[model samples]
Target: MENKNKYIILTTMLIQSTLLIVINCTIIDTSTLEALKSSMPIFNIMILITTVLMLLSLKKANSFIKKETELELVKSNMKNTEDLLNLLRTQRHDYLSHIQAIESLIILKEQEELEEYIKGISKEYRITNEMIRLGNSVLTAIINTKKEIAEKKGIVFHVRCKNKVSLHGINSWELSSIISNLIENAIEEASSIENEKWIKITISYVYNNFVFEIENTRKINNEIGDNIFKPGVSSKNAAGRGYGLFIVKNVVEKYNGSIEFKTTEKNSIIFKVILPSEDGAYGEKAI
Candidate 1:
């Protein structure tokens, strides 16, 4: 569409220029015609230069758009793969526990104990099934997977999510990326503390925005400064690292949303995100 508009505008301009040139040529004297003919080469050169520049600009713009689209698709696929891997890991870990329980029960050679072990497994399955009744499968899967990891690390993970959320405006891949990275970072930082570590996440729908807040226990040093979101600015000492916050900022800003960070002297950090409702237009109120 943009290319077509540009072409139409250029064609219109060329036709108007030709007509004006003809009209002026017919009304002008022979001296003027000679001068116009002599200046024809310059005019042609200018037109050629303009056309080249326009085409070059269009090509560059098109390339950039294509590259951006490709990057987005790759990011989406990566998120899907990550989610699948997390699920698989959880299942594998659970399977190990089941194997251990079965091995112990078989060695006891007691029929009653064997039946009880099977019942225990059934009860565990029922509990998992009940917990996943939250309606949003993605959210349930992610929360359950993370919960397991946090428990394994002896960190307290708390969640306060509303019944259902409008996922319309946001791409699932980008949303998952943002949430996963933030939670993972919180967990990692919290685990390093000597005292009890905790991460709290709250997701709620307010007026015309979907608000997400994550708080974690971590000491923020002066090294973070104002460049915490800058790519490759991580305190983790490895070169070519620190792109998590950069990714989060890019995804949030794409939807005209806002994110902020607050840190207390006591080493508690809170990250808040306010995104426009998917069904609402920019600067418009939600119904």
Candidate 2:
């Protein structure tokens, strides 16, 4: 659409300039010098008006593009929040079932099974608590949602976070895009395989930087070589399949962050993103 608009503008200018040149040449030959001079101001005014209108159009185009980008970010944040709320509701139902089961076990006087059941519940709650303690609702929601998706697809998803990691300078929307895109890609790749399907994600704070590392079982697709982060490049042959990593790379670089991926000898791929905890020298400090 943008290129089409540019071509239309160029063609319109070409036709206008040609007509103006033809009109001036005819006036120069058939009219008095004073008459031609009087017509020049009219031509000048026409050019001025066209230039001003074109400038205004260009300004509006830029503003529209900016708003479109902001709208996408807002939509992403809202989806993440909705997923988090849904997961919370599911957990609430699960807690009720757990309580009922425990009461039943107690009534049945199954001491050994009750002990084992309580232990299992404790371990599960610990993992959930750790994820909640990450202190960023966006991150927690995206990871949890992706994990659920991976599990439903028969892909094991594991997340490890030992500390309270925080993203001080990054907004929820940007953070959501980065983490969600990477993990979603991992899940998709892992799910494609028939065997040994699994995804592992590790979040940590190291050396004043927040680190996100996702690894998944994937066969090497040589088509993606070094240009995996480039736009319109994808292992999948579907339309609109490759822009996720490209956007992720752009957001990471916008914050002076770095992203790298490597394939393991075990037929697994890992993507690692490192972003500064504080704002980078050239990064936006809003969030």
Which of the numbered candidates is closest to the native, going by highest lDDT?
Answer: 2
Model 1 worst lDDT run, 10 consecutive residues? 278-287
Question: What are the models' TM-scores?
Answer: 0.63, 0.73
- For residues 1-287, what per-residue lDDT tens digits would candidate 1 score against the true structure? 35454564566567557756764665574466686677677666766766765676567668768668657845754665476466666766897888887888789777798888888877765434434323345555566566657767988887787645565777766777677777878888888898969988887777778788989898666678578899998867888878888888888998898888889776789889888886643342221
TM-score of 2: 0.73
Per-residue C-alpha lDDT of model 2 across residues 168-225, encoded as one tens digit per residue: 7886788888988898889888988988999988877777787889999996587686
lDDT of 1 at 32: 62
Q: State which candidate has the highest TM-score.
A: 2
Residue 270 of candidate 1: its Cα lDDT? 89
lDDT of each: 0.71, 0.79
RMSD of each: 8.3, 6.4
